[model samples]
Each structure stands twice: as C-alpha cells, then as structure tokens.
Target: MIACLWARAASRKQRAGRESNREQLTAAGNGSAGPMSKKTLARPARGARGGTRRRHLTVLFTCVGRRVELIQAFRGSAERLDIDLTVVGADKSELAPALHLCDRRAVTPTVLDPGYVSALVEVVRSEGADLLIPLIDHELPVLSQARQRFEESGCLALISDPGVVSTCRDKIATYRHLKKHGIDTPRTWLLEAFAKRKSRSFPCFMKPRRGSASFGNYVIHDDEELHTLGRRVPEPIVQELVAGFEHTLDVYTGLDGIPRCVVPRRRLEVRWGEVSKGQVAKDPRLMEIGRRVAQSLPGCRGVITIQCIMSARGRIRVIEINPRFGGGAPLSILAGADLPGWIMRERLGEKPRIRMDGYTDGIRMLRFDQSVFLDRRGELL
Candidate 1:
C-alpha cells in the first residue's frame, strides 16, 4: 500500500511538470501570459516520524537574504554549543559561514514553494533537524507548521506554538495579546483606511502591521505626514513616539517555564536596517518586564528579544517582542549569558548555570566597514 501511494505521488509530480512545461510554452508563444504564479514557493511542513528518529541537534536559520552581519554572530555562538548550524535562506549562495559550518560550500536546497511547511517536514526527516530556530520573521509560518507536524510525528520541535508565533508576528495581534495578558505596550491603533475623524498629536510612529528589519518604519511628525504614510502602507499603525533611551532585553527561558538569563543591551548604532553596535547593561527593570512577557506567551521556548522604549516620563514602554534569536544575539553572549550553550544543555537534560557579570558598563562596540577584495586572479596575476 505504501509503495502504491509513493508511485501515485511520483506520477502526479510528473504530470504536473509536463503541464507546467506546456503552459510555459504557451506563454512564450503569446508573449502576454503574465508571470507564472509561484505555487512551488509554499514552504513545507514537518512530516511524520516513521521510526525512532535520531536526536541530532540541528539549528535551522531562516532568512530572506544572506544576512552577513548576523551570520558571523550566529556561527560563533553555535560553535560554543558544539552543534551543527544549518542556515536556510532564499539566496543560499550568500551564506558563506553557515555553508562552511555545515562543511558544504554548496547552497543547501530551500523550500521555495509556499508549501514551506511540507518542505521543512521533509528536511526535518532527511537532515534530522531536531531544533528549528527562525532567524527571520518571514519564516515564522514554516516554523509554525513544524510545531504542528511534530506532535503527530512525535518529533521534538524546539519552537513556540504556531498561534503564539502568528500573534507575535503581527504587531496588531501582538499588541492585542499583550493587552489581553495585562502586559504594557505602546499605545497603538490600526489604520484600516485613512480616517481624519480625530487628529493624533504629532511625533508619532507609522509602521505596517506586519514587517521586519524596519522595512517600512517611519516617524510621522504632522497630520500630513501621517496621511502620506497611511497611503504608503495599508492598515498602518500610529503610535506615540516615546522619547528616551531604547534598550533590548534578551531573555532565554527553560522548559520549566522559568526565566533563565535576561541580558540587557543598548543599541549603540544601526546600519542597513540592523543593529550593528550594542553594549550590554545591567537593567533590573528590563529583566523583570522580560520575565513577565515570557510567561504570558504560550510554548515560550528559545530566545526572545524584548524591545522597549523609555518614555520621557521615565517609564519603559514595551515596543515589540521578537520571539526568536535576534540579530544581536551574540551581544547577549558577551554580556555573560551563554545563551547558545544554555539552549543545548537544556535540550540535553543537563542543568545550566546562568551568569551575568563583567558587563555592568563601560563596554562599547562599533561596526565599521573594512576593505574587501572582491575578485582576484590566480598566482601570477
């Protein structure tokens, strides 16, 4: 029966390929068939575990492009855990260190199909990925699917619940969920359509409900700017732009639902839509808030970076929560929290000792560009 099913699946794939070819030919001849819809772009879901799957620790990093800045940080952190790191991105060729860590310079195949869930499930089975950590928010859906399929397969997925991930990914839903849990967040409203019913005070932040890397984050000063921003991104959000220092509290929770280590850091500088330079700080308030937010979420495992803005009123308002290993994860490590090592130890049933010292203050980091050799000719040249 299994063999018959496999054969039928193969036959369907072959037929689909043939039909796709015919459509391609038709489009080529007509010159106006429009672009082909990327049905194959669906990310895959985790599959059922057929046998007793080997529990090899695999860390999956998902990204849209080659995130060179954070790749080095992740690679160095993963080395401390003594676990193989596999990065999954669209432009796999650009992930040099990740590919090197896997000991394969070639591009690892990606689940381009929107069926990313099924594609990832196949990968989990084939590559034996036990822990799937998302490096980018865009890959949240696939991670969500993995969590769902793991139950049926009895496979261990080191990820949060799908509903939680979805709710966190969408800022509107995240604010709602936090509010429902009595968590403090910046005053925000969803702008479904342009409405001048009431004018908000100037110096507000206009952002899309769903996005990453500050793709469309803008600060609108006046009503005119808000209107322009509303036209730019639909369903935009306008929040009171808090004035004060911004800080991120990077926290790691355990299986027992306790806050393991909360490392606070201040963003010194940012470039290309990423936090470049950061310094660790000992902030008790940040840690306290982080613990509360972590407990509020369901299936809260892995690393979460809580972004908070200190208001002029001397109050820290939660701005956003990234429920995954963030770009500045390494900074947390430097701050005396061995986050990567902690994750591995927890999964392996070993108790980890959390520490945060020597990072009280007076440490600064700056990201500067160094000269690079693009291409070179061989020996004599």
Candidate 2:
C-alpha cells in the first residue's frame, strides 16, 4: 500500500547529473569504489505524482535525541531518490535539540511509561507516519513487542521481532548464541559462575548484562576488583576481554533478515562508549565475520550493529550485538553505504542495489558537537 503511494508520488524524475557519480560512494563495504554505471537509472521522484493530494513518506523517530546528522542524511538521500521525506521527532522532553528541526515534533511519555506505545501509535496516525524508528537500545524490547500496534496504524516499526530483540538485549544471550553457532566470541559467565570457577583469568571485563553504550562497564584486574565492582554493577556479567583494535561493523539487514551491506570501521577513539574517531577497515576476515554473524543471528531486521575486537595477529572476536543503528552510523552513510537510502528504496517495493562489501574503505569520521538554538519561547530562532 505504501509502495503504491510512494510510486504514484514519484512520477517525476530526478536531475540525476552528479560529479564523479562513482565517487558519490566509497567502495561497497568490502568491495572497491569506482565509477557508477551510467547504464543504471535511479527511480524518478523529482516532484509530486503530478497530482494535488501531495503525500510524503512520513518517518517518525522515537527518542530523537541529538541525531541531527541522521535527520540530514535521510532528507538528502530522499531527494537523490526523488522522495519527499517528512521526519517526526518524538521524545519525552520538549527541549530535545533534534526535535526543533524535524518536520513534525511529538512529545510523549518515555519508553518505560505505560502509555508510551499508545502515544506512539497516536503519533503515527496523526503524523501519517509510514515508518517508525526507535533510536535507543533501552526501547528495543518495548518497541519490538508493540510493533503490531504500529502496524495496525499502517506503520512499520524498523525493528526485529520481540524474541530477537530480547535475545539481543541480554549480553549473556548474545554470547551464548554466538558461541553455540560456532562463531568466535568472547567467553562470558554469570557473576555466580565466576566465583565458583578459579581458572578465570585476571584482567577480565564486567558490565551489566543488559547494559547499552558501555555504561556501568569495568575493567577488573583481580578477584578483589571483580568482587568489589560486581557488587556495584546491576546484573553484572564477567567476560574475557580481548584487547586489540576495536572494530564496529555497521550492517544493514533487510526486513527479510538478510544482510545487504556491511562496513567495518576501526574505532580510533571512543567517548561515552560511542565512537568519536574511526576509519573503515575492509579486511576480508572482518567482512566475512560480519556476514557469518548476521546470518547466524535469526530475525535480524533493519540496521544491525556488531562490535568486535581484532588482535594484532589478525584474530577477531565478537563482543556486542545491537539490533539497531549505531551512534556512528553517519560514517557508514557518508562512506556510501547508503543505508538510509536503501531502506527507503526497499519500502518503496524496489530491490535495493546493494553490495555486501561495496562501501568504500578508509573513510574516516571525526564527529563533533553541533548546537541547536531556540528562544525562551521554545520556538526555533
């Protein structure tokens, strides 16, 4: 139904002339970047469907906090695809910086609130949102479970199924799932098991079993430190720490549960548990691991984030799995993965032209803070 509307609205063609069209993207995630084939044509979407009932594809983003880069990327990609995009920023606070610039702003209860789902459903209806993206890890479970509610409102929630989301939310579950499927992952244990076992190595790591963005994480060097910090962190789990260059794989998994693209970037610097400086590493081994990991994880939907550690000798160990877009996703987007654009194309009933390793390599992102200003009246200046 949405495809019909989108197709009808995109009756006009885009101006398609771009400099160094191939340079528009780096290589595919692991593939080489080169000139775009002039033989291929992008879909037409220059203007309204030659009619007056103008309807743009409305996308509602939950917890739209400090995601200005993403908002800009979506609008830019939409234009390239001839899509008229409308972004709705939904948050609990009226002061969210990203909210001020969205096509529409919706203030609602936090994800933990009992009324959150219903409020989101209402937002979907009122804003004519065809797509809903939950940005935070804490909201994954709730949004996945309530996906049906949004679907009833003719909106598709860009998340995995409830069970998939549940498994991804729990660190222990992710560890077990990866190990059970013959994937190389860091060894993990519950706090109780660590106490019973004496062979555990020192300098291990511990964090909340359900933690996100590396919060409440500790690096323990001995039993005393482990026991002391374990008591402080809620639902702590101990895991062997594989030290080396940390690499993040920004994977775009289609709604059909297949990975469309994977871009592995080595984290050069991390701030508040998010990547601050990073460069793409198109090592075949990393690319292969990403493919296997995505294939093993059942029901992965939309953008899937995988964190891994690679030793100097070239061994890679999986560390974390986030069933949503990562904070540094703009890097991949700018590198030419076109994750946002591909997602839009898929919903428009088009087969995305994706190369699993087609994104350019060595693309680096240096992220900095950008401020949004508003008057005391809470209106954009």
Candidate 3:
C-alpha cells in the first residue's frame, strides 16, 4: 500500500513537470522570457485533477519560537501551490510570536517533558497534519526518534536521523565529526580537560556543550574570566576563538539524503545569535565548502545550516552545524533561493530543478522589529 501511494505521487509529479515545461516553452515562443514574478514562479504546473476532491494539506510547526518569517515563507509557498494549507503552530508558550500567525495553534509540552512526543503526536493526529517541521534544537532529537511513529500515522516528519541530530546538538561531537571528514574545525576541549591543562593561551571562547541561541557563551581574555565562566556555565567547552568573517550556509538535501542546493550568506551583524544583517555571498570557495559539508553528513535530510569562518589567512574553519532551518533562512529565500517552495514540491514527491547559483549575489538583508498587538480579551488586533 505504501509503494502504491508513492508510485501515484511520482506519476503526478511527472505530469506536473511536463506541464511546467510546456508552459515555459509557450512563454519563450511568445517572446516573453525575461523573468517570472514570484506568484508565477511559485505556481505548480497544471496536472490531472482526480485524486482527493478536497485536497487539504496541513503543515504543523513544532516549537515555533520567533520564526515568524519562516511561517510567512511556508504560507507563501502554500499560496503558490494553490493548496488548502492550514498551518498549525505548536509551542510551549502562548506568547510565542509565530503562534498568533498560524491558522490553528496549540501549546505543547516542553521537549524534556516525558509526554512531549505523545502530545505532539496527538496534535498531528487531531489536526490531520500532513507534515511536521521542528524548529528548535532540543526538539530535533526527540522528533527524529519518534519519526517512524509519526510516519505510521500517515504524517511525514521532516527531521534528520537521530544519530545526526545527536551529533549536531553536542559541540564536542560536531567538532569531532567535521574534523574526521577532513574539514577544518576550531580546536575544542572540555571544561574539565581545559582546567587540568591550563597551558593554552587566553582569549579563547567558551560555551555550553549542548545549547543554542548563543546562550551562556563568552570570550575570556584572561585567566580570571576563564575561571569565573568555567564555574558559571553548564558543561562548558573551550574552543579557539577564530578571527575572520563568519558565514552561514543554508543547504538543502533531498529525501535521498543527497545535497541539491547550497546558499552562502555572510553575516554582517548578529543579535541574540541570530543574523540581523546579512548579504548573499557568491564566492566559489565558500560554496565549495558548503557543498563538502553537506555531502559529508549522510544522515542529514531537509535543510541544514552550517556556520564557518574564513580566517585572515584565507582558510575556512567550520564552527557549528544545525540540522534544521536557521533563523536567517528568510534572507536566502528573499535572495531567490525559494527554499520554501522547493520543500513544498519535494514533500509532494516532485523533484525541483537544482540551481546552486540561482540566487543573486550581493543582496543585503536588514532586519527590523515589528509589533503585534492584542486586546484585553486575548484576541489578536
């Protein structure tokens, strides 16, 4: 039964692809091949119309924190596909900014809670969500472990393998994995090991072994601060403080776990560990490094964000890897990567044409704050 369903989906994708080709040809013949608008570019090619009459596709985003831009991207993708998309947002708090923007909303248990997985599964079942996208680091491992259970309930969970998630979550594990793949990574030492050695120079960086959003991260310029932070930070790991330009690469791999596209964006300014100002960098060296990193992680699927630094000496050193969409992914999408649209097509069993250099270079993104108002009755204004 599963094979049959997949076969049917593949057939539909082929028909749609052919139709899209024909439309493009028609447009070219009419001498109108300049550039397509966003709406036209997002529209799926016309295909046969007799599967399910009411084609409702629900995508549930779990741990939707401050990803309002990501939610908007998916909403735009659904509009382009002309699908009846009901975006369901789930978070542990009602005050999550993205929650108010969802079509339906639910508050889920924290990932460490014993009932977290069950609560998420219940939301998927009750809302009839067709897909699940996890947005936070801690939830990735949990969701990846429960992926098969969600699949059994006829919902697709967009997550990497549990082992891959584990590696990405732990700084020590990530450093080791990348270094083993012949990738240059910052030298790392556990807090205890560093404390014992006491031989390395100061001005090193330290952070929790398993944390995100730049929490509990510090740069110690002297032995005094190092000792102070070592006692304050939890499970701290010391790493060489890299000096150079930092870049974030947004990479997308297909369901087959093969990387299809990579977008390298240089970080100009960051706030709260999230990119506040960035520019699309079309450097070939950075692109090559991104490709190599994506190809090395065989268990990674969907979107993987890599952080690296290009030193003053002109060598690239990897810093971290997050096996999900990064906070600044919207910048890549706006630069014409169209990742959200590609994800939607892939989820429907369609293969999107790979365009590694599709996005424009030197496109800058400047982010600003927006306000959301609520009434006394707790309703959105």
Candidate 4:
C-alpha cells in the first residue's frame, strides 16, 4: 500500500510539473508574475458550459516559533491573491491560539508526532495543499522527500533533491561541498577519531556537524578547554574561528536560479538560540557572498540564508548555510522584501520584481515575550 501511494504521488507530481511549465510560459507571455486577475479572466457563472473553474490553491507553511510568524504577516497577500495558507507544526493547538491575531482563515494542522517525514506527506496530501513550504530547518528533510514523492499530486513542494538537501544539512558537509565546488569557505576538520593524550593547539570550536541554534557549541580558548569539551562531545570538529563583524545574509532566489534580493544585517544580539537584534549593513561583500552561494546551489529552491564573518583582512568567510526560511525573515518582510510571497508567485510561474536590500538601513530587534510566574506565599511575616 505504501509503495502504491508513493507511485501514485510521483505520477501526479510529474503531471503538475508539466502544468507548471505551461503556466510559466503563459505568465511570461503576459509579462506577469502569476495568474491573471479574476476580473480580467472572468469565468461564466456556475453551471455555465463554457466557463472555466477557478482552481483553489493551498499553500502549506511548515515550521515552529518565529518563522511561523511569517504566516500571519503574509496572510493578507495570500487571501487577496486567492490562496489559502495552512500552518503545520508539532503543536497545532498550542499555535492555533496564537494565529488568531492573523487572518482567521488560516489553519494549523494536527501533527501528532514530529520529524516523521512519511506522516507529514500524508497530512499534506489530505489537506489538498498545492504548495509545501518548509519554514524551519529541521523540516527540510521531510519537505524534500515530499517533493520527490508527490510532485504531481496537485501540490508543489519547494525543495531540492534529497542528495542536495543532505549535503546542505550538515555544516561539515556544506564546507566540503562548497570547497569541492571551488567556492571559498572556512577551514574545517572533522574529528572522527582522536587518540587520548594527543595534545593539540587551542582556540577551536567543538560542536556537532549537524546542529543549529548554537546547540552543543563551545569556543575552546585553550588546551584545557578543548580537552574538557572533547570529553563532553566525542568526534567533534575543530575549525579556525573567523572573527570581525558577523553578518546574516538573506538570499531570496527566484525560479530562474538567480538571487532576486540579498539583504545583509549585522547580528547585534543573540538570545537563546536565535538572533534577537540586528541591523542592515551596507556591505558589498554580503551580496557578493550571497550570489556566489546561490550560484553554487542552483538546485536549491526557495529561501536560503548564509551566516558569514567579515575578517579584519576584509575577507568574508561563510559560517553556515540555512536551506529554508529563517527565523529573522520578518525583518526582511518589514523592509519590503517578501521572500515567501515571491517564492509562491515564482512556483506558480509568475516573475516578481524583487527590491534588493529593501529593509531600513538601521537596527531592528526581534524579541519574543516569555511569561514568568511566581508562586503565591504568605510567609513574609
């Protein structure tokens, strides 16, 4: 049964791909980014023989936390354009309450268990979604699988192949792939095996090759620190820390395999595992690096971010590649650069004019409020 379903979904995806190609040609002919306005392409009333039916498009946004905040911001655009945006995550009930602040038409899918790619595909199919947009990093793998399995199922999953997704998922792998592709990246060494009592120099970072949110990351300033962290997490990599001003480069690539917009922001503060405060920077290196990376990952569809460092020597080194919508996406949206909407339009065969560096040229902080409570007691006498 599983095999049958997979086969069926694959067949559907191929058909959708063909249809998408035709739509792209039509959009190009009209010099528009998406379907024509309803008024311009009016259909006869229901039950009329020659009237074309308006296809209802379902856009699925999958993620957690602030990245999910984008669903609210883009709700109006989706509605005005006759697209339904469904937000899916592990906690539907938990997030459903918060979504009330946005368009009431949006819905949160009931994801009983997280990280199950097969289950996620099932939910997407049942929802009749036409597009699957992965908003969080962890969800990328599953989204990639859906793209492969359900290409023609009347839904479009904006993702690259699994091989590319896996290659981009790990920091160590990304470094190697970029280097192999002739793209300059930071020097990194994976510590697969290290004999005890083998002493080395200091000032290296020890963390998992596949990790985010600064989890399990430690800056070892000396030999003692290295040994201590080495004991904590085995088989860790040691790389030269690139110093100087660190910048987060948001690269929104269109369907033509070109970066339509690139926004570089200086990371001012980091709270928990996310960027809390940042500001747009007027650095040409940011755009250069973003373009280079985008060119390298031509198969990578949708939004991608690169965390880079500007060394004192004026050289830029890429720290990591995030292959999905970022947590700080709202900042770019506020600046008039809407990557998500652009992606939606592009997938539907519409070409959008992106205003590169559309955000304000100043500091902006994305802070989320957390509730703190105390127990009531009367023992103060």
Candidate 3 lDDT:
0.77
lDDT of each: 0.57, 0.77, 0.77, 0.59
**CA deviation > 4 Å runs, candidate 2:** 1-55
Model 2 over residues 1-381: C-alpha lDDT tens digits?
122232223222111111112111111131222232221113222122344433256778899888767777777678777677877788888788877657666778888888888777777766557788889999999899888787766677899888778878898999988988898998999988987896979889999999988889999998899888999999999999887999999888877889878899999999999999999888889888888888887788899899999999998999998888888888888788898888776765467879988878898888777666768876555
lDDT for 213 (candidate 4): 78
Off by over 4 Å in 3: 1-56
Q: Rank the candidates by lDDT, best first.
A: 2, 3, 4, 1
How well does candidate 2 score on lDDT at residue 283?
87
TM-score for every candidate vs. truth?
A: 0.72, 0.85, 0.85, 0.72
RMSD of every candidate to native, in Å, equals 12.5, 11.5, 12.8, 13.1
RMSD of 2: 11.5
For 71-151, candidate 1 gives per-residue lDDT tens digits of 444345455554444433222344333322231112333445555555444444443444455566766656666675743
Better of 1 and 4 by lDDT: 4
lDDT of 2: 0.77
